[model samples]
Target: MKDDTKIVHVGRANAKRHNVVNTPVYRASTIVFEDTQQMREAMDGAVGDRKKVMFYGRKGSPTSWTLEEAMTELEEGFDTVLAPSGLGAITTALMAFLRTGDHLLMVDSVYEPTRHFCNGMLAKFGIKTTYYDPNIGEGILKLITPTTRVVFVESPGSHSFEIQDIPAIADAVHSFSDQNIVIIADNTWGTPIFHKPLKLGADISINACTKYIVGHSDVMLGSITAAKEHFPVLYDGRQQLGVAVSPDDAYLATRGLRTLGVRLNQHQENTMKVATWFSERPEVEKVMYPALPSDPNHRLWKRDFSGATGLFGIVFKQTSREAVSAMLNSVSCFSLGYSWGGYESLICPSVVSHIRTASTWRYAEPGIRLHIGLEDPEDLIADLEIALKSFNTFL
Candidate 1:
């Protein structure tokens, strides 16, 4: 089925309660069984079929399962597990395969918090991480050591916006490794609607459902979808970590998911209009969006992705911090804050040069990340024009 059709129908078949179109929230903690035999069967089912049978509240309820089912269908994976937030999903997936003394190959452009987990928690656990260039492609084989258990890739890396060649990296890891080495891709930016990591050879695919999947800023949730061979371990690890999402959040995420296709379409349309406008501005050094034909990574993005999201970065020309602040502060429509993939537009300064270790950030000028949102493109442009005028005045 097409993504739009699947989005509306995937999890709704058995989700309805009393003929309701949407799944009712099942607030559960302790599930009561009819008898001791039933309880024994439930325990066995929990161990054997975690998705279908819920022995306890932490294991998951129908509400959460509906979302999981929908995500699994969207991601084209064997199954999926839920987490409290995007970072929780990443850490849970990492801990599932990693152990003490293991080496991790992390993309230099990974999300900042993921890098922190590698340097702080994973390092504390005695695991070694080697950050590699995002554009390394098949050359990633050089970084794989005998101890390397996982290679993490985030295409269009956080803030930097470099699209990693996922297929090349995954092929390299599988070809070079004698032992089982998993390739995990963060699909938050290139959501299942745009790109399917599993189809591109990744062993595991992760999505910050808190973003596009939720389609709003109201709920925080994440999903980890695994290949068949890796599902058992991923599921066991999530269960061991006691990682559980609130059913309320799950329900809202699912509700938001229904409009994901339409919402993202509008987001892409609005973003293109805004990004093109920025490209024409003298104060803008570059509009870092892969969807643009002029972008360095556009060829790869075009090859692998069906569409682009609302998020993109804008690099400013040589400018003062005060001028940038003036622009950010003067914006009436775009909120100066963190987080993206909401109905409302947002803008935030992104400085990644200091945080990177594997590759150098050559641009001396700072950049602003923008989430174009669902607002009318003309209104958003008018707002940005005013902000840019404010920026020029300060300059």
Candidate 2:
């Protein structure tokens, strides 16, 4: 499909007689089969390897397929699966690839929530997680074990903002064995436009659609997109786990994704401006954004990243957590909270220690993550200036 055509109809269909542009949402738990043979066919395989099916609402309704089709087009070589939440997608993708005795290599700078799940749940299942430095690249090969079944990467490591050498890492991980270790990337930050993880060699690209994809922050959804080789398992795992999302949610997501290109552009522009603004501040000792000129991974970022979003961190030297809070609360425009990629700006004190066991988090002070929104940069900067004043006041 052509790019524009793909955007409009890649995952959508005008299947009914009315010929509506968007897929009609069909909500159902019981699908009546006309005959015994029809019932057997419905049970055989809802969606076939060759074509789509109206097999079961659980496999996905037309509404769900519309979104999946669009997402698949955006992510080159990826077959997609939907999850109830971002973590649901994350956990489901992992479950599809890992057996009990399998080992997994993870990035140390993964989202704390993901890290928490890894520590608490994956470990209990007898799956060992070895966290490598985000910058390790092909050097990761030395750390891989025969039992390693998956390599999970969250590039520009969530709050830490460390850009990874994905192509290099992919080449190394794939050489481990024919055991076919899956390369899973949490591509939520980049979506598919800015960075095509699958095209770069990842086996799977997962997203917390709750962030940018949904745009409104009103919906909670996640997606796990798979390379052709692994699409079957992703879909199978989602099917068995009963990961069907509501049609209403799917409709909202579809609408939100239509504006993703424009929204992401604004987000990138605002984030660069905000990161630079924070970097020059005396109170901020370090800015943990890959786009920063002085960042350790700046070259890698420039080479691989088409853009960025509002999820960068700023560390204040010699400032207490209370001081950071005071400033964050003082800001008129930057509301203190979690979750990002919404139209409204948000600020939060970011804590990244769960996976910091290998390296000491020896910053002079704790850091705060900010999500710059569509607000005027000047107004946002002015609000931040006042917030800094409050920080100084607390000092």
Candidate 3:
């Protein structure tokens, strides 16, 4: 079935609920067994079995399982694991694969907290990390070593928005090493709709369901979908770490998944309008959006992704810090916030130099990231025009 159809039908229609359209949230902690033999099976390695039977609350409930199955269908993976937050899913994936004395190749333009995890926790655990440029492609082979165990990538990165060559990197890792090296991608921005990293040859794909997957900014959730061979390790690690999401949050995320395809299309349309408007403005130096033809990574995006979303960046030509602040604060419709991929629009000034280590941010102009929402494109453009006037006054 097509993706849009799958969005509404996969999770709810196939659910094993008793003649109900939606899976009922199972708030479970202690699962009762009829006999000692049943309890023994649950306590033994049989708990690892893929059967839908509940062993413990920390493992998962039916509500969370419903979401996981839906994500697995979308991601085209063997199974999926849930976490309380995006960072939690990221750390879990990293820890599950890497061990002492292992080396990791991380893309430089990854999310700030991901960089923090590599530099801090992974470093402390003796797993050395080498940050490579996001556009390296097959040249990533140069960074790999005999001990390299994993390659972590994020396409159209969190702030800088550089699209990576996932298939090239994945093939390079497999050809260069026979150690069962894993290729992991933070698929939050692309999600499964636009880009399925697993199909692009990645061993695992991850997402912060808090953003677009939740559709609203109400709940925090994360998901990690793994290929068949890699699913065992990730699943075992999640169980060992006791990482599980709230059942109520899972229900909300499931509901959000139903409308994700339509919502993302709207986000793409709104973002294209705003980003194109920024391109024509005299004050704007550049608009960094992969879907834009003039963008540096447009070709790569066109080759890999089926669509684009709301997030994109803009750099002002000759704006000062004060002017940037004034512009951001003056916007009537766009709220000043960090998180994106919600129904509401948001804008934030970016300082890429503060977070990156492998490469330098060359753009000297003041930069801003925009998350265009479900509002009318004309209204958002008018709000930006007003903000620019305020910025000019400050300058």
Candidate 4:
């Protein structure tokens, strides 16, 4: 089925609840069994066949299960596990395959919180993390050690927007027969609509449902979809951690997901328009959107992705803090805030050089990340025009 059709139909099969079109919220806590034998069977099913049974409320109910089914199908994975937040998904997926003394190859442009988890928490657990260039591609094989267990990738990396050669990296990892190395890709930016990491040889795919899946900035949820060989360990890890997402949030995310394809199309169109305008501005040194033909990572993005999303970054040629602040303060349409994928536009300054351990952020100029929402491109451009004028005032 096409993505749009899958989004609308995948989870609605069991909507037989009162003949409803959507899966009704099944807020559950303590499920009771008629007898000890039934309870024993449920317990067995929870461990032996997780998808077919729900032994406890924490395990999941029809509502959350529906969302999981939809996500698993959309991601084209064996199964999926839900998390309370994006960071929860990342940390849990990492801990699933990593053991004490295990080494992790992390993309240098990974989300900052993921880096912190590796450096701060994982470090304390005796695991070592080595940051690798986002562009390493097949060269990633050279960094593999006997202790290496996982490679974490985030395409169009956080803030700087560098697209990794995912297929090349995956091939390199799989070529090494010494140890079974797992590959995890953060699919929040590429999203299920555009990129399916598992199809590209990634072992697991993660999505911060808070962003595009939730569509609105209302709910906080995450999903980890794993290939058949890796689902057991990933599921066991999440269960051991006792991670669970609210059924209400899961329902909301599912609702938001149904419209994801259409919403993302609008986001891509609007973002491309705004990003093109930024490229023509004199104050702009670069527009870090892979969709742009002029971007350094465009070839990789075009090769691997079917579409782009609302999020992208721009660098000012030479601007001060005060100048950037002035521009931010002057923007009427774009909200100066963090987080993206909502219907409303947002802008925030990013300083990534300090966070890099293996990468050199060549651009010393101030960078502004923009989430071009569903707003009309002309209005957003008009707002940016005013902001840029204010930026020039301080310069």
Candidate 5:
């Protein structure tokens, strides 16, 4: 079935729920069982192959299970586990595969918090992490050691928007036989509709459901989709950590999935309009969007992804920080904030400088990230034009 069709019907109308359209939020810490045998089965996770039956609330309920099932289907993976946040999903995947003496090869352009996790928490546990250039591709194999247990990747990274060669890296990592190298991709930006990491040879795919999947900017959710060989370890790790999504958030995320197809199409349309405007502006140095043919990673993006979303970056022409701030503050249509993939447009400064260690971020000018929302393209462009003009005043 097509993505749009699947989104609308995937987790809806259960037979036991009187044919309800959506999964009802089950808010409970404990679930009662009618028989001791059933209770034992639930406790042992033998009630269902998918573990959809509730034993304890921390394990999951109907709402979260429904969402997980849909996500697993969407990602074309063996299974999925819920996480409290995107970071939780990342940590879960890493913890599932990494050991104390293990080595992790991470993309330099990964989300800042992910870098923090590697540098701070993972380091404390004696797990060594090596951040490599996002464009390394097959060359990543040279960095792999006998101790390398995980290779973490993020395509068209969060701030720089540099598309990585996912297949090349995946193949290179999988070539190691002495140690099992798990490839984990952060698929939040691409989503399932744009890119399927499991098909690209990744062992696991992580998504920040708080963004596009929730759609409304109200719910915080995350998920980890795993391949058949790695699903057991991921599931066990999640259980060991007691990671679970709120039933209400899960329901909201499931509800948002119904319209993700339509919302993404509109988001792509709006983003292109705004990004193209920035490309032609004298104040702008470059527009960092993988979908743009002029972008350095456009070929890789075209090869790997079907489409782009609303998020991109615009580098100004040698502008002062004060000028950039003035422009951001002056924008009316785009709100100055973090987190994208909502109905409302968002703008924020790029955060690649301080967090980067493996590679240098050498932009000619200051840059700001733009998350084009559901607003009319013309109005958004007008807002940006006014903001650019305000920056000129500061200059």
Candidate 6:
């Protein structure tokens, strides 16, 4: 069956419980054992498999497994592990595969927290991380060391929006050695709805479900989807780490996923309109949305992805931080804040100079990330126009 039809039916099957379609949120840690053998089986990984139809809750309840199964099927391979946050999805996936003295290759335009995880956590564990240009492609072969175990990526990276040549890099990584090098992609921005990194030779796909997967800002959760070849490593990591999210949080995430498809389509549409408007504005320096024809990565995006989301940024040519602040603050319709992908529009200055390595993020002007939410496009455009006017006036 297709993913769209599967999304509605995959998790909700049992007509036995008041004919309820959604899985009941089973909020319990202790399970009443029927017998010693059953208890023993519960302790084992056998009960945790969704195919088994019986779970003891630490391994994940039916409620959580339903969502995990839904996500795993969406990416077209293997099983999945759930994490408390998006970073959990990334870090746990790394912990699942990498060991001491393993050399890791990461895309230069990676999320900042991921870079911190590489520098601070992995460094202390004797793992060496190497960063390569986002456009490196097959040239990445030269950087791969004998000890290279993982190639971590975040395509159309959160800050600069550089789309890495994932298939080329993955092919290059596998050609050199049969030493089980794992490829990981942070699919938070992709949300599995648009881009399936696993199709491009990625062993693991990580999504911050707090983004489009949840389709709302309320839930904070992360998930890791793995190919069958890599599922055992993730399962082993979960068993060893004893990581699990609360049932309440899992319930919210699952609920949010129901409308993800429609929500994402709207986000893509609204963002395109806003980006087009901003592109024609004199005060705007450049729009960094993949959907924009002017974006450098637009052609690559066209070749790969079928859809775009709400997350995009605009760089304004100016020296005035205060002017930027005024523009952000003066907005009446849109709220100034962080962490988007909610029902409401949000705006904030995202410019940072803390970049240490890789390409300098020096924009032609200071930049602000815009999350086009479920607002009337004209209202949002008017709000932004007035905000730009405020910057004009305040300056």
Which candidate wins on lDDT? 4
> Per-residue lDDT of 1-395 in model 1, one digit per residue for the tens?
99999999998876556898888898989999999999998899888546477688899888998999999999999899999999999999999999999999999999999999999999999999999999999999888889999999998886988998988888888996577999999999988999999999999999999999998799999999999999999999998999998999999999999999999999999999999999999888888999999899999999999999999998877767788898899998899878998899999988889888989987755678899898899999999999889888887
Please give, for residues 295-353, the per-residue lDDT of candidate 6 as tens digits.
Answer: 99898888777789888888877647778888988898788877877878888887655
Clashes of each: 0, 3, 0, 0, 0, 0
Model 5: per-residue lDDT, tens digit, 1-395? 98777877776645259666787889989889999998888877733345667788887887888888889888999889989988889998898889899999999999988999999999999999999999899999899998999999998798899999989998888888667789999999999988999999898999999999989999888999999988988888877787877888888899898889999999999899889889998888889999999999999899989899999998777777888889998998889888998999999977567777778877755679999999999999989889988889988
lDDT of each: 0.91, 0.82, 0.90, 0.92, 0.88, 0.82
| TM-scores vs. true structure, each candidate | 0.98, 0.95, 0.97, 0.99, 0.97, 0.95
Question: How high a TM-score does candidate 5 get?
Answer: 0.97
Tens digits of per-residue lDDT, candidate 2, 299-339, equal 98888877777788877787887888788879888777788
Instruction: Count clashing pairs, candidate 5.
Output: 0
Clashes of 2: 3
Off by over 4 Å in 4: none
Instruction: Specify the poorest-scoring 10-residue window by lDDT in model 3.
Output: 44-53
lDDT of 6: 0.82
C-alpha lDDT of residue 109 in model 5: 93
RMSD vs true structure, all candidates: 1.0, 1.9, 1.4, 0.9, 1.5, 1.9
Report the lDDT of model 4 for residue 280: 91
> Which sections of candidate 2 miss by over 4 Å?
1-5, 15-17, 47-51
- Order of candidates by lDDT, top first? 4, 1, 3, 5, 2, 6
